[model samples]
Target: MKEMTGLVNTKNKNKLPGDGVVGKTCNNVCNNKTFIYTRKSALTLLKTAGILLLVLVLLAAFTACVSRSNQEVGDTGTGTGTESSSGTGRETGGDQGDVQGAGSKDAGEFPLTVTDANGVEVKIEKKPQKIVSLTLSTDEMLLSLVDKGRIAAVSYLSVDPGQSNVAEEVKDLQKTGLEVESLIAMQPDLIIVADWSDQNAIKQLRDAKITVYALKTPSSINQVKDAVMTVAQLVGEKGKGQEIIQWMDGKLKAVEEKVKTLEDNQKLRVLSYNNFFCTHGIGTTFDDITKHAGVINLAAEQGMVMWQEISKEKIVELNPDAIFLPAWSYEGFDAEEFAGSLKNDKSLAGINAIKNNRVFCLPEAHLGTTSQNIVLGVEDMARAVYPGLFE
Candidate 1:
């Protein structure tokens, strides 16, 4: 029966056996003040346990919500967060991995795929942040394209004068040759080599799962632009490469136009020779440059890639109108002074090129590097041969 004044019956005799009860002595806590005291100390323990259980459940629910939020961020690669949870001993559906920052292309973007000049399929992982250059020429090209800080290592000879331009920038990276240990230690995202010549090195790097690419080095001008463009396409900088090519094409067209105006009587005969009096043979890049400059290359009779002694009589007989000698520093040869000596020699006095005072010094920076330097060489040759149109 209900108590008078609408109070709850506090007598344990009226309560269920399983209903563990505790009460404060205060009348406010129970129907009668005389029925209980001291918070019904023993029964209070039961309610304390129940209160703790409720709090733990709420905490677990909150943690699960937080973990789900992090999972959303991980999928989007946006917030790049980590989440941990503990509840009911059975957890599911949490993203696990390191957070990859958004690349220049897009967030979670990776694996730039391409087919190289060699017609082999290639793939790059994780937007290469660090690069190691294997050739001296790649070292020069890297100087113009990416930041110096992005270069991890370069070939030893790249720092020498007349070979590389970014010597000061790559001082530390030149400490060791392109050894696998040294290259891997730099943590480079990619390694660029001239060709497949480093098969052993490539195998070692691939065993360790490092990405490497073989860049092309063309023997002639026709292949030069194509090689440079190939590298640009691989690195997602094709737009920049095409722009440079367009500029080169326009420059070449300008030179060709100038040559078109020259009369047959005005065709200059140019003999392009390497150091130690070695001539650039048939189908050399100099042939294209000289032909564009309205000059005839005298070395067309020789074989491809190199030339043997063509006899002093043949040189005198051809009598090129100008001797276009490349300035190079080799064993005991001062490129500039040597070219001057060749021009002033008593034996060469009768040669048409020597008599006409048409000796030219080509920049060593041009022919020494890679395909990119070939463009520079062509420009230099064009300007040196015909300065009026170039200026």
Candidate 2:
């Protein structure tokens, strides 16, 4: 049997503040000036007023009670989830996703609630066994945390060794496109997509009740660690997540110690170059790596807060201390040819990196990564900036 509660109308229609029984009674009492108020008449009037006051107080209390009850449990007919005082979902357990530090709860517990990068709270009734990765970063993070069997598919980018750190392991998994229909066909229990993925596809996937983790691009080492840890918690691999973070921290601390002895002026001014003259600016993973590696990003120095292409004239003017070419190892790309072109460009002839032959082509796997391997990118950069210190 379903239980039901109806709203109580507590307004007292019979009693008003002015112009009624009280008015008539007062008029009659005052009209007879010779009739002085005996104790009996005065007590009768007091009793009448006291009864009206009691009715008003009772109505006010009842109204307040009803409002508070409604606020606590929103429209009960609808199945909308409730939020606690902290804004975390009022599920059996506190928000599993927002949990920090090493988790103590059994991750295998059913009906888990997690807050994704999009700030949407997702509830998983059971552990996700079949996962699909829609981005290269998530592909690498997943492979590092879960078993190969758990990963049903990975993005097409993950199949290319030039663009993915886990390409070797994910080469056998089926590759997926960034289409809603394609994702639906996979019937994934969980899907990990980037924050910038197609909104239409994300909406369609969510409409189909597919659990999607819209992971964001990390701007710093701490954010990278947090991303990895968040995924680990989602995939029931918190231990593996902690291990990866610890490893990254060890590598980063080594670089920090090496750069600790260097003076501020001694830090190298560097620029990251793709095939085109484009580079990442402030609030980017590459920019953060440059900071950790004890080098200044020339693009950031120019007040570029996002990825932008610079004119050849500007490149010559900046004359970076070292030039990092991250795309030199892409399948058919010829590193030597690119280097020759940089050296021969008349506009870039006066650049310090070209003059000193310090243009370095870093391995694409680590250099372009925003995942845990970013620590490797930081280490490689630090080595290039201060060659003898790393050796």
Per-model TM-score, in order, reads 0.64, 0.71
- Shift in Å, residue 250, candidate 1: 3.2
The local distance difference test score of model 2 is: 0.65
335-385: candidate 2 lDDT, tens digit per residue: 556655776788887888877767776545566677777777777777766
Give candidate 1's error at residue 379 in angstroms.
2.9
Model 1 TM-score on a 0 to 1 scale: 0.64
lDDT of 1: 0.53
lDDT of 2 at 304: 93
Candidates' C-alpha lDDT: 0.53, 0.65
lDDT of 2 at 169: 68
Instruction: Give the best candidate by TM-score.
Output: 2
Q: After superposition, which runs of candidate 2 have C-alpha atoms over 4 Å from their true positions?
A: 1-108, 328-336
